[model samples]
Target chain A: MPRWEPDAVGRLQAAAIDLFAEQGFERTTVAEIAERAGLTKRTFFNHFADKREALFGPVSERQRELVVAEIAACAGSVSPVDAVLRGLQAAADVMFEERRAAVARRREIIDANPELREREWGKRAALADAIVEALRARGVDSGTALLAAGVGVLVQQMAMRTWAEAADGRPLREHLSDALLSLHAVIGQRSV
Target chain B: MPRWEPDAVGRLQAAAIDLFAEQGFERTTVAEIAERAGLTKRTFFNHFADKREALFGPVSERQRELVVAEIAACAGSVSPVDAVLRGLQAAADVMFEERRAAVARRREIIDANPELREREWGKRAALADAIVEALRARGVDSGTALLAAGVGVLVQQMAMRTWAEAADGRPLREHLSDALLSLHAVIGQRSV
Candidate 1:
């Protein structure tokens, strides 16, 4: 029973992020976010279950579906790590490529709040679990599936960190690829 | 102003784990844990900051110090992953080899509670940060250092899972070594 608004979700997210940045996440309220976005609390509720969810909810499910589908579609001969990176790259293309500033802002907000950081960790853990299950569906052994998924999550984290900090407008996929190479180089280097 | 009892910390931890496992973590109180250990709540607080820390506090710092020291002592010719695995193996020998049952029980307790799981994740992240710092001190680049430390954590997790589930009573160091080999096999396997 809500009037349709163009880009309600987008407005709500932007408003929420800006308010959180301005007043701090703990002090921000859903009603204030709705007011800032020129929407009702009911409409905000329709879009997100809570303030934290406003920042993270939509992308997790969408990214999970996209990454899992991409993994399923990969050639049978792709290495587990490579398959995971491919899925991650595909997800980056869809979710992160054009959202650099927003992503950086979100990171800063999450970093400033311990509760938000815990939720972010939970989200990352769930993403790794999804990737592990996807790899298992491809007949990967459980142990290797978990390792590859863990590696994939680590790569995504490293790439995201690098992408967020880089002033150059480099694509997230390139950063992801660079992260994978860095991992390989780290794993490959001799102690001497 | 406290009389030191032999193994007071150990007794408190064992009591906390048993109570957490028996009646669930949320319902278990610090006072009850102390009583079960035949110690005062003051004694318990002396050993741990809270009920949750009873399970994780002492070992994390010790393990961090041990692993960092081992990483620092590795031969100059060892690969980063190898050096990390070596450090992990050294720590496992001291802290994990003989504590399989207790460790498994602690994992089960943490796994059952969302808050505990978050704390566990935080502890792990801190450990990874320590490892990254150690690697950087060794002249490894920051990106590669983070990646290697992440892989080290993954290897430790895999080894811990395998060791906790194994009935053979094998040394944890062996499982740590086996996990490293498994990771190599996983990353080395051709997708085709």
Candidate 2:
């Protein structure tokens, strides 16, 4: 066995989701989640700031960092939308490609609790801001950058919903690109 | 003085904002706001459920109902984007056209507090869901309806920020229409 498990944080998140669903998010305790995961409370704290953080903390931060970095690194030939798509594709590969079951369960937990849902909104808003900043750095104006980033995040929202519910095990990037196409179709032929 | 005040709710909102800005939301009490408004606690409770409710209670609910009803009323004779814009224009006419300064202050208070910010987001999310339902009722598919609603809400968000900060004192309806136009320009065009 490896000296350190590759997915300690993932295990903690899984355990937390199981506990939250079996009971309610409000009633489930961190101690119970730790016990279920066969990890010490110290280990849990090392991985997540608190019980709520287990569901939202690391994944959001890592995704933000990855997307912003990827956008910053895109070649000059790419359009802003394509750059955002590229960034989202990179983050999706690391955070979501093989984690469908866990992602679905986590979504259920968030949907069931108003607080969690609000936090999820906050996370997405923060990510949108990060993407906008990256675009601005790449010389996009404030207005266009804001709109493109908002559209990209909206596509992310749609793609994630489809990914969690779709029967076909298609990659999230496919849905994301499809959503961008749909956005194009809807916005149809207006001059920017 | 009129027997029935025209702006009892306005007075209450102002008092609540002052108290919250001065003492913070959690520390401020409903009774204090009522007293500051020269009304009894019963009057405050009659207008709102609690202290926090004073800031968000009526405007949010009224906006949602107005937009959804407007969309339903425009069920025919327009595309989905046009329908959503019509709904948003109706809301701007009712909720925000004359309340620019008051709206700015309310936004500031919410910005100062995490709880208020979350509730504001919750209200925005609720409004988006209501729009989606209205679109679906008009025979739009669930996916397109959701995207239309999301884009409409995004337009609302952008228009609101601009209106709140715009010194030109232009009408919110104009900004909203302008935003809808810009959204059409951005998403309507397919570069590929």
Candidate 3:
């Protein structure tokens, strides 16, 4: 057997993204990803369940866990929207701050494929549900929890888009903060 | 020749929803739905592209058109989020006011199946996109348009849940207005 690699998952993901971008997601095979990563197919299987999972798997679970935990840890004095924003910010600081290029590439791959876009939507819905559950645990009303969770997910989406398109290299957390502020501004603006 | 039915699409949808809810979506066949509706398979095909579309077809397109048209007709001085709300309200008044039971059943059917849930999410995303495009046509900036559209969708979701769960027979538009107020209250609530 070959020596163990510490970053097998990261390597496989990088290789998969590169392959999916260069060719197409449908055209790229798992074996090619493993080969490009200088790893065996068995190792790839050990890391990811399938080719699609290689693009989005454990990372989403980890992000969800981080966000939920952050929400749980937030002070009760914080407002519902602020609590959700804090949770999202905490997750973004760790998971997405340094992965701008990878995230952009992943977005492109998902945008190009309807199947991947469907899965992406599922993942997003799951994340929002998790946030809702967390908010409920904090004794928030179900209606408020759902709305705040939806807002959190929407803010994250807007922040991701702005961050991806930004020419300046700002951190994801900053984009998130800006997006939250923008949401406030948009919602607060009324016809005189 | 058989006599023509005025509500072929409605009959097919009702038949499909009943069959799907009873026997599960995968096990139910198009022919069974058509037979149950007292219509031929060709009639079902004329009404819907596939078994899945039977549950959600032209109604979604009509909802989109109503919303877009309402937004387009709103005065230029209207705020983006309010414009979206007005559009949603107009569509809800016409398309959803008397269809609470059917809407609830549809929600249950979609909730039970992951595949249907995915399609529902796609339809929702499409509606949001249409709203964004309408707002842009009115000269709203992309970011503001996106934010308003997201807020509008979020409010609609909250209103639907409330309207569905209410024991007292309240109109959907009232639930929508209440949801809008709740959103404002949630967002306005700040930590001192």
Candidate 4:
């Protein structure tokens, strides 16, 4: 049995990110992260399965839930792609708009490591799959659902990137709208 | 130094895919794959770095080169997304169209493994990066280039999936065109 620790996950995540950014992710250890967080290795194990999972934390899962819930709330009359965009925009508002600096740091750390990069790709794919399921629940065909999910993923990616990197103070939802318009223009400019 | 073997890469890939599909990818070994190809482990190393790489083989790199070459040859007058579609269509003709069965087998083997799916995502991203570079060289703005590349990747993914699964004898390029049109319609249906 383990004793309770207040805000242990938050402390551990902050400590882990700082250490990973300071000494590089490969060289950092779970023990070091636990020490920095003023917690025990057992507590670390309680929250995350490993060092890699620590890097990602739980925010992604929360965001996925928010997006799926938003999609489910969309009325059947809403277009499939529109529903996905609405879900992304809603999640961005709740999860990402306030975490600009932290999100940027996480992106940098993941970008620097190939294995982390792959894991990030897997996470994005999982989110897309969740979106697809939500869209299918609204009676959209499989093909349209898939393409809409694809576009939604692209919008999230583009919006998150710009929201994190750009010095401008635009909110993430605005970036989502911008990316959707940009994608619309790109697809509409088709040659074939 | 290794002796020259006729179509060594082809034989190794076919053998590896068959064994992986027959006896699961993790259960299969490089030695088993090499034996199935009637080649030594040394020959396998000379061709691919590992069992996973053997699964992907050299076809992806060849396709990338063909796509970049096609993009470079496109006149500046062509629109950015159009140029990307043309490049993808050109590569499909030379690399994928006639090898539908082979491509389907490879996709199945990759899809069965989570790690391989991440790698497949990475490969698609790499192709998108190559497209971005090609478009940048043509003086397209970076944002537009990235979005165009993103759309191109989506088009490739959808086309490859349908071409592999659909029993109808439509060519890969036709699927590419169809996917592009579908994407256009999806994006054009945006609510926001």
Best by lDDT: 3
Q: Which runs in model 1 stand beyond 4 Å of their true positions?
A: A1-9, A23-35, A38-52, A112-114, B1-7, B40-51, B75-79, B190-192
Summarize candidate 4's per-residue lDDT along B1-192 as a digit string, tens digits.
566788989889889989988999999998999899998888999889878888765777888888889999998778898898889999999989998998888888887888788777777777888899999999999888989888888889999999999999998999998999998898778554
Looking at candidate 1, what TM-score does chain B attain? 0.93
User: Per-residue alpha-carbon lDDT of model 2 for B71-147, expressed as tens digits?
Assistant: 89973767777788888889899888988988888778887887776676677777888999998899988888878
lDDT of 3 by residue, A79-170 (tens): 88888888999999999988888899898998898777767777778899899999999999888899888888899999999999898998
Q: Which candidate comes out best when scored by TM-score?
A: 4
Cα displacement (Å) at residue B163, model 4: 1.3
What's the TM-score of each model vs. the native?
Answer: 0.86, 0.86, 0.90, 0.94
Can you write out model 3's per-residue Cα lDDT over B68-152, one digit (the tens) per residue? 9999999999999889888999999999989898888888888888878777777778788899999999999999999998888
**Candidates in descending DockQ order:** 4, 3, 1, 2
1 against 2, candidate with superior TM-score: 2
Check candidate 4 and list the clashing pairs.
none
Per-model DockQ against the true two-chain complex:
0.46, 0.28, 0.56, 0.61
List residue ranges in candidate 2 displaced over 4 A: A1-8, A40-50, A189-192, B1-9, B20-32, B39-52, B188-192
**Model 4: native contacts recovered, as a fraction:** 0.62
Show the lowest summed lDDT stretch of 10 residues, model 2 chain B: B183-192
Local distance difference test, per candidate? 0.86, 0.82, 0.88, 0.87
Better of 1 and 3 by DockQ: 3
Lowest summed lDDT across 10 adjacent residues in model 1 chain A is found at A183-192
i-RMS, every candidate? Answer: 2.8, 4.2, 1.8, 1.7
